[model samples]
Target chain A: MDIKSLKNYLYWLYCQFELITCSYLMEPWEKLLFYTFNITMLVMVLYTAYIFVPVHISTAFQFFLHLLGNQHENTVSVVK
Target chain B: MANPSAVCNGHLHHHHQKQNNLLKSGIYKKNGITKGMKKNGVSNGTLHKKTITEHFEQAPMYVAVLTFLGFGVGTIFGYLRDFMRAWGLEKRNVAAEREQQKDFVPLYQDFENFYTRNLYMRIRDNWNRPICSVPGPQFDLMERVTDDYNWTFRFTGRTIKNVINMGSYNYLGFAETDVNALKTVTIELQKYGTGICSTRQEMGSLDKHVELEKLVAKFLGVEDAMVFGMGFATNSMNIPALVGKGCLILSDELNHTSLVLGARLSGATIRIFKHNNMQSLEKLLRDAIIYGQPRSRRAWRKILILVEGIYSMEGSIVRLPEIVFLKKKYKAYLYLDEAHSIGAVGATGRGVVEYFGMSPDDVDVLMGTFTKSFGAAGGYIAGKKDLVDFLRTHSHSAVYATSMCPPVAEQIIRAMKCLMGLDGTTQGLQRVRQLGKNTRYFRRRLHEMGFIIYGNDDSPVVPLLLYMPGKIGAFARRMLEKNIGVVVVGFPATPITESRARFCVSAAHTREMLDTVLNALDELGDFLHLKYSRYSKSSHPELYEETRLELED
Candidate 1:
């Protein structure tokens, strides 16, 4: 993956991790908005990866993004 | 403007700005640098939903750990506080126990030392004795008699056989172990449990209380009777309950302590007459009527005359007919305490009124106790229904104390029944008659032997005069050596020089016992160097009185 892709993926992973961890400490409005934004960004990253496009995302960024996505799914199911 | 170096530098600057925005929002703002970030146009973390979730995640784990630590520390501190308190109490208890042990002394030695130093010296020196003294003259006399007579006064674990109880107030010997009476008591105990916990006004009173009162009233020939915890309490409760602030009490000087306490508590004006002196009583009565008037207007209410049916220490009977005559003449209420008379005097052992054949109505109030002849504890006052009704409401002692245990009341009832002839009238009368005969025989025999006896000729109490106060101890010691029990009463209970040994005769005494006691007395007279011839002369000095005539102008 390219540096630009790596940086964007890293930003997305950081947001998802922050949204899940911060949810316990945040008020309900902040927690809901952050969670929705992370979910939208995570779907966009996964769709870009699945389309076989020449994505510029780096290996490290992909690894972190995958870890955040799995954690987000687990947290959402627990809340439901 | 398309310079390659400039374009690259611009791209690097834009990328740095975006990364700085993300880092400022995530790291610096979340780490609480709101003031610095807000100045740089970065929004403060106004995310309410995120903050709430954060608080929930932190509360559970933090609260659990803090609460558990607090509880553990508190338990340890609480245990340490309790241990320190218990240790302090143990130290205090040990000190108290050691002090008590160090001070302990035999009661008899203490009593003797107290009496000799305090009582005997005061009497010998002609100083007035206090009302209650330990080693008082009276106790000295008792000790002297016990020593001289070789009497065994076994205080602990007393039984019928071990005791030759000359100090007992059981005048007629009715308190003797009667098989039939014991059976009655046992039957009553089986029927009723041991005690009733409430006062008479409450559920504590039982049918036995009513029955005992009824029997006592009938025996005394009065309208009714109200029971009390003791004979002393009867006077203490009834007197104050009956008379109030404006009333006057004319008391005989020799009336029992109960009467004195009762009168004092009543807040009444008390005038004491000479012992058994009706003239003095009449004078006091006349004076009260004349002087007990209010300065504002009319006279005060009539006075009350208080006397005992029998003077216990002197063993003298009250001149009841004269007292009744004076009561009627002055229109005063007469209150009689028959503590020592009932079950001992009168034809049927009905006490002073019966002994004198006077009507019960003549005496306004009559009180007696069960301890003497009834072989039980407690007392009763017999009077008109209204007076008893008033006392039931006002008597403080009655209202405050626990009610009498049922077994004691039952015993009194059975004893009263036995005395009044539920068993048989003939048997009861026979016992009383025998007691009268025994008293007469004992008194006559002692008088014939030249002993100066105190009291009326028919009285059961025969107080032998021992004249020399100093010899009281020696005389008592000799008497005790003979295994005959008698009490010596001297100063305080009696006048200093009037010290004497008081002998009580009971119906239980066999003829052999009387003979044995008389023989011992006769032997004691010689042993103590007492001259029998001087007894007649000293006891009857009136025979030597010379008549003188006075001239009037």
Candidate 2:
């Protein structure tokens, strides 16, 4: 639907592919190569998450502040 | 046109004309006018016309709309029915839960689990990938992918050439690229086309059939002979005709399955004698003659003793002289199946009787197959003229099955002629002698190697016993990797734990080629720890002596 959702869908597809291929890669050397491929995919996903983390944390903090303000107003009204 | 009554009259007139046209075309018919219409003092045609006009005027739009509604509802119903069917297929049927009860598998399902899933069968599948070349000294076999770590089999579909052939029943190597056999085959192919396309009883038999029968009878010194298309069926189909329910059949324990099956189909009481054990056979014969039959206490109409010239599995030669003595003593007929022994044994290659210096007449029914010795096809029942004639008329195999292909029969005839010294060459006799030499040389070498082998010393069929079921696959794999084709047998062909590889010696094999095989086997035996029977070398030296004595006789 959106760029972020599309990216998530692509990541999901890659994870499924990796899982299936991991089972198929049975030899020790093949597993070792697959392990390297898995680590690379993990690192790429981590880097993407790092780029979007600042915006995500700020938005989460603002939502928590608005909830606290509403709670305080409700408490004052009850006291009155 | 604007006046309502005038417009209505014009529409009525058009409808009346259309009705009249339909009546003239004979599309509509009326039986007889009703009494009420006749009594109305108006004619029947006028009354009928009035009734039709009245009916058409009433709700023509309603009828069309009703028809469309019916069609739409019917289509919707059809779609719903199809959707329900698909949905039912997606779910498991509760009614079939009875079949899912524990251990309630169908017979075929049990077979799949027991036989198809067996380890040896799996190994066999991997061992025998089809060969592209002739089944001779060297041929190509498709490689099987059984290695680990492959997600899927990436079939190379390429053939490996020049793999030493140690399988196939090409006893004298006649099936190989023999110039004489091939030339005969070419000529026969042109003369006979492919097959006769009819049963032997019909128009299938050609002059060549008569020629072959005569040659076989002459070669074996029998009065007459009859041939069947399939070697296996020759025994299974003909045996029943020879003996029936009132008869008794004493079969050797280790005879080929075809003989055992034939004896069973005869509906005779079957008694098994220990393989190549003359004493056991004599004891059985004595008891049968004395006791008559178990429950009936009546003497048997006839008693038939069945034995193979050479036991295919154990490679032991039948004690023909001793058996013949017992058959005569008991007044029982002897049926000797020489499917394996005919082509590979004796000085002249006439089979066991020739090897043992006995009369061919000693065997009442002399059954031998051309598949092994002639390296062609079909089998023959050779005996007295009356027996041959009787079988010709009554044998189900001859009557129902198509005769052997003319080319195959010709190949057999050519091979026979060569063996008989009629081809004006020493090549046939030389090949037979070479086969004897090769068989003895290979068996002796294997014995000297401390490898536990089965079979008589002179037998071309040398079975190297492994005794371990698990290692059969390993031995086969190792041999194939070394580019040698070998046949490995396990249960139920042999005992459960007595798995072994059967190596049939062909005359085409040179001394050097056999040594190459021995070298590979030695390495494999060492790697797999298969040299357990090293100490038990030549368990039956007396059996070897017996063969020598028979040869001397």
Pick the DockQ winner.
2
Q: B148-224 in candidate 1: lDDT tens per residue?
A: 11212222332212224454565655564556657767777788877766777767667888878777766665567
DockQ of 1: 0.00
The TM-score obtained for chain B by all candidates, in the order given, is: 0.68, 0.77
- Model 2, stretches more than 4 Å misplaced? A1-80, B1-105, B109-116, B126-128, B146-155, B534-553
* Tens-digit lDDT string for candidate 2 (B1-553): 1221132231222222223322342421242223322454433433122121000012234333433443333233334433554477333211232446747753443422343232333344444467787777667887556443221244577777788888878888887776645997889899998789888889989988999998887667667899889999999999999999989999988878888889899899999999777889989888998999888889999999999988777777888877887898889999999999886886767788767645576789999999997888899999888999999999999899998899888888888878766776666777788889788878776776667678777788888876544356557777988888898886678754456798999898876788899999887776555555534445525354554565454
CAPRI band for model 2:
incorrect
- In candidate 1, chain A reaches a TM of 0.39
lDDT for model 1, please.
0.61
lDDT, model 2? 0.71
> Mind giving the per-residue lDDT tens digits that candidate 1 earns over A2-74?
9998897777565433322323223345457656876999999989778755455565667787677755677
